[model samples]
Target: MSEKRALPWLDSPPDGFLEREQRIKSQKQVNIDVYGILRTKDVPQISFEVVGSTGNIYRTIIGNVPFCDCPDVRFRKVQCKHMCFVLSAMDVPSELRYQRSFLPSELREMLATLSLKRKLDTTTPTTAGEKKPVDGECPICFNDFKPKQKTTWCQDCGSNFHQGCFEKWRAAIQTSDNAVRCLYCKLPWKGDEPETPRPTPKAVEPEQRRSKMKYPNVGDN
Candidate 1:
């Protein structure tokens, strides 16, 4: 399973406390569910007031870019869950959905779907008989010219990396940072189907193994 990084916004305080305070002062408290939070979009602003079952209301602000009236945000300049929750509620763009809560299996499936969607979305208009090659070079290693080789290219941007190069690059990137996107480029490989995690062998039952064993059949023959 890939070790997912906590989104900066989820761990740090939101930005601009005074500005957030003004915004929160105008809005009312809202209810959010877990899944609902994931689907929300980025809005102009979001404010969270935690009354803690008690009457004491603690209010904080989160924006698309995020601003909060909390000291942590002002001093440390980081995003807090309040910001993440608000952003999720706002249905922020995928680029901004910083938190990754999906399990490895779920992430793999998501990536597979994303890969397919990318392919379909990027398919150029062409006749059935004609296969046209889009031209582009790798921005990282610059192994651009593989004139005679049939290579798998990125469906989103027509960037082509040699299959061998891609494999080597991915292997080298396996340990740089836990689940950090490859330093060579922004491409993420940590989520690749985790090598079927090697199974731990259990102790064999002696009686069952002895009973099931097959002896030479020469005597019966």
Candidate 2:
């Protein structure tokens, strides 16, 4: 849980980074999940769109080298989470994916799986009362709770926080005895498996995705 929004890069290794940096990057990559990554439609390929941990979307472009629009990527010029996502979607083996060259792809099969599955299915939260957490608003970030985003709950106080905000709060108390206390109640909070946001009222994934995906293979283009 790190509250540092202007935070340092997690799993990103700088260009020509050393072995120690590589090891550290690999370890942190585990904590970050690739939400969704799509191959852009421009000629010779342009970039990939990735849904980030904070429930925001970012762009990852493969140029003379790999790059992401996130602050960490721009400032550090390292293989940030968004690039990790782009590489992961390409099905590049873990060892190869770290290199900038491997981030770009001509593989359509891999692209298909990620096309519309935006957002990580990390955790769904309980909102207290009868309404589902997704139905109510989050206590922090002030954004409406979305089923697609990772969410957390406090059983004691029945308050819910988005995953990013939850981790941010947890970071704030790291120096104190209560690491994961409820911000509202100061009660220690327990961790639980996260739930994905429920499908929207229409719930039309299977039919829609299949219809939209018309290309037969990478060679088709």
Candidate 3:
């Protein structure tokens, strides 16, 4: 009888595994964006369409057996940048990111967290003019603002949020009217005015210019 393959998640990762994963994450050039997320009804698996740095789209699955179709994973048999992007974007913990498998309960918790975030993203804030202290977690991502991180303040409410998080929140709640409003105060965002094309200057006719002149030039005769 053939022996069963051991689960990778059960064993400790190889030496330098974490350092290598960190290196991949720190690479800004390996840009990635999630196109969409798919969840299986019967299976505990979740799939993501991740756009990679080279503009190629790859399928990444997180569940009993984590998988990524990127060349780095298929050939090297190691975690790839696309996998790192998906996990990091979802704010998955560092300990779980390296795991090759996840329990059903873990997947459920992740999905629940994501669902709550989506709800928060789409729901407009009703409370207006209530200024939240600058030190708390951002209402959008629910993450604490780090020092030196780019940030923006609500003009009316005086609430502060990470600039990137605020932008995402603004985008999610944008209306057909093209109005950008403060997330907390629900008032029109002062500095985020929509760009309008500058009006073209009208040309003045020579006759009109001459008519308006207080004194006619002698050379005009």
Candidate 4:
């Protein structure tokens, strides 16, 4: 009977492995000297496994990342030198760090956190030179409507949405409420009012004709 054997590469990777792989693959060269760094062993020991050029197997332990120069990693997608080198440099043993897969919600939270951080970092107060008057013409109307103009602002998204566009946009969304803001641009507009019943016009009564005064003619005769 043949003995059962384990397949070499049947495990899933960590959260950022694919992105990192793509980025690493895009790079022409990685300068981390895997052998030199591994020899010192000052930092964490990162185990690397890579297939090098012409089927050469190169392995090195360095910093928190691992590097490999094998043909599998470089020419083919089986395994690459850069990934091995990065793994070795990072001192991640074969199994522990690979289990760090993030859920969808966790990934969304991470992305949101990153976006918030970026926004906060870029939130410098505007200087006097940066302040500009709102003199530009409206792109939709092809006419200048200053800031002081009595126009409804879109609350959902702060865009200079025209009133006509707002009405059309609101109608397109098909809401029968008394007032509705546009779904697309978020501009506020009044909805159709409940029509009051108008009274019908009445026919005027004909005035009674007065009899001619025959008494005046008798007095004259």
RMSD of every candidate to native, in Å, equals 20.9, 18.2, 16.1, 32.2
Residues 62-120 of candidate 3 have per-residue lDDT tens digits of 76667887666788888776676556655677787777677666676666665564345
Off by over 4 Å in 2: 1-46, 62-64, 103-221
Point to the candidate with the largest TM-score.
3
Report how far residue 120 has shifted in candidate 3, in Å. 4.1
* Candidate 1 vs. true structure, TM-score: 0.23
| Most lDDT-accurate candidate | 3
Give the C-alpha miss distance for residue 132 in model 1, angstroms.
9.2
**TM-score per candidate:** 0.23, 0.31, 0.49, 0.19
- Candidate 4 overall lDDT versus native: 0.33
Query: With candidate 4 superimposed using the best TM-score fit, by how many Å does residue 156's alpha carbon deviate from the native?
Result: 25
CA lDDT, every model vs. true structure: 0.35, 0.44, 0.53, 0.33
Model 2: how far residue 95 lies from native, Å: 2.3
Model 2 per-residue lDDT tens digits across residues 11-118? 654564455334433432211123233444421333654334433335566443567766676776666765664555444455545655522233343354443322
Clashing residue pairs in candidate 3 (N, C-alpha, C atoms within 3 angstroms): none
Better of 1 and 3 by lDDT: 3
Q: Which scores greater on TM-score, model 1 or model 4? A: 1
